[model samples]
Target: MKLVSLNIGKPAELSYKKKTVLSGIKKRPVQTSLYLSNIGFIGDGQADLIHHGGEDKAVCVYALEHYAYWEETFNRPLPPAAFGENVTAAGVLETDVHVGDVFQLGESIVQISQPRQPCFKLAALHHEPKLALLVEETGYTGFYFRVLTEGKVKITSELKRTEIHPAKITISKANTIMNNKNADREDVHMLSQLEELAESWKKPLRIRLQ
Candidate 1:
């Protein structure tokens, strides 16, 4: 896949539901090269560290392929970084890639860890009450990458897959399963077994199993 754009942002107050809260879901596109680390891009940050900005989810990625559908849905010009992605990608979708898929980005190496768990912050940022649930339901929720090799990654960098995981659990499938109320115990076990999957994801599934 190709990197269409790189985005970054710090925490800022987001107002919604008659309340204001600090959120880091409104990212802006950047044109310069960025230093990628185990935690994230040098300039990137998240307000709620408990649910964001960790080594297992250093880079949030959204596909450019899904933009047309969403733009049509929203009936407006949804631009790059619209989903608060650190990397805007082209030529790949949630169903086409799998957990533990390793890719090289410019001088850095990264690996897919988990599908993005769309939060209320995203819905609030877009002024859509059900947007987060909609994203989860449609399996267009995007995904995250864990940096393996820290280095400078240019905005123009192209991603090349270096390795594929044995489990082959596509992000799309994971999203669908995640939203299912009747999620199978065997399916949950299979998903929990993936070493490349992030603990934030596995923890819930593990609890369900026990």
Candidate 2:
């Protein structure tokens, strides 16, 4: 897959729902190469660390194809980094990428950890109250990456798959299991046991399986 854009943003206060809140969701594409550390992009910031940034979610990747889908569905234009993804990529979708898949991007190596769970911030950012719900329903919520080899990366870099884990629980499947209230317990248990699945995802599944 090709890395179409590299986006970065810092925390900024914004008026949402008549209240001010700090958010780093409005990222813009960067023209120059940047460092990719274990935590995340060198200049990127996450306002809510509890559900956002960490070793398990260092990079957020969104499929460029989804922008077209959203634009057509919403009847409006959407930018590359509109989803607050660190990498806008082409040729790979959530269904095609498994949770344990590893990829080499420029000089850094990253692994797919889990599907992104849309929150209210998305609706507030786009001014569409149902946007987050639409994303979740469509299962187009992109995915997260955990940095395995820290190095430099650029917008022009290509994403090359280096390894595919044996479990093969795709991000699409994981999203379905998490969002479906009646999801089969056996399936959730199987996915939760994947070593590559993020703790944030497993914790909830474990609770559900109880």
Measured by C-alpha RMSD in angstroms, how accurate is candidate 2?
0.9
Q: In candidate 2, residue 108 scores what lDDT? A: 96
lDDT of each: 0.90, 0.91
Candidate 1's residue-wise lDDT over 1-210, tens digit each? Answer: 788999999999999899999988889998899999999999989999999989998999999998998888899888679898999989669989999999999899999999999899989988989999888877898999999999999877879998988888999878867777588878888998889999989988888888
What candidate 1 gets wrong by more than 4 Å, as runs, is none
Error of 1 at 33 (Å): 0.8
| Every candidate's CA RMSD | 1.0, 0.9
What digit string (tens of lDDT, one per residue) describes model 2 on residues 96-118?
A: 88999999989999999989999
TM-score of each: 0.97, 0.98
Give the per-residue Cα lDDT of candidate 1 at 117: 92
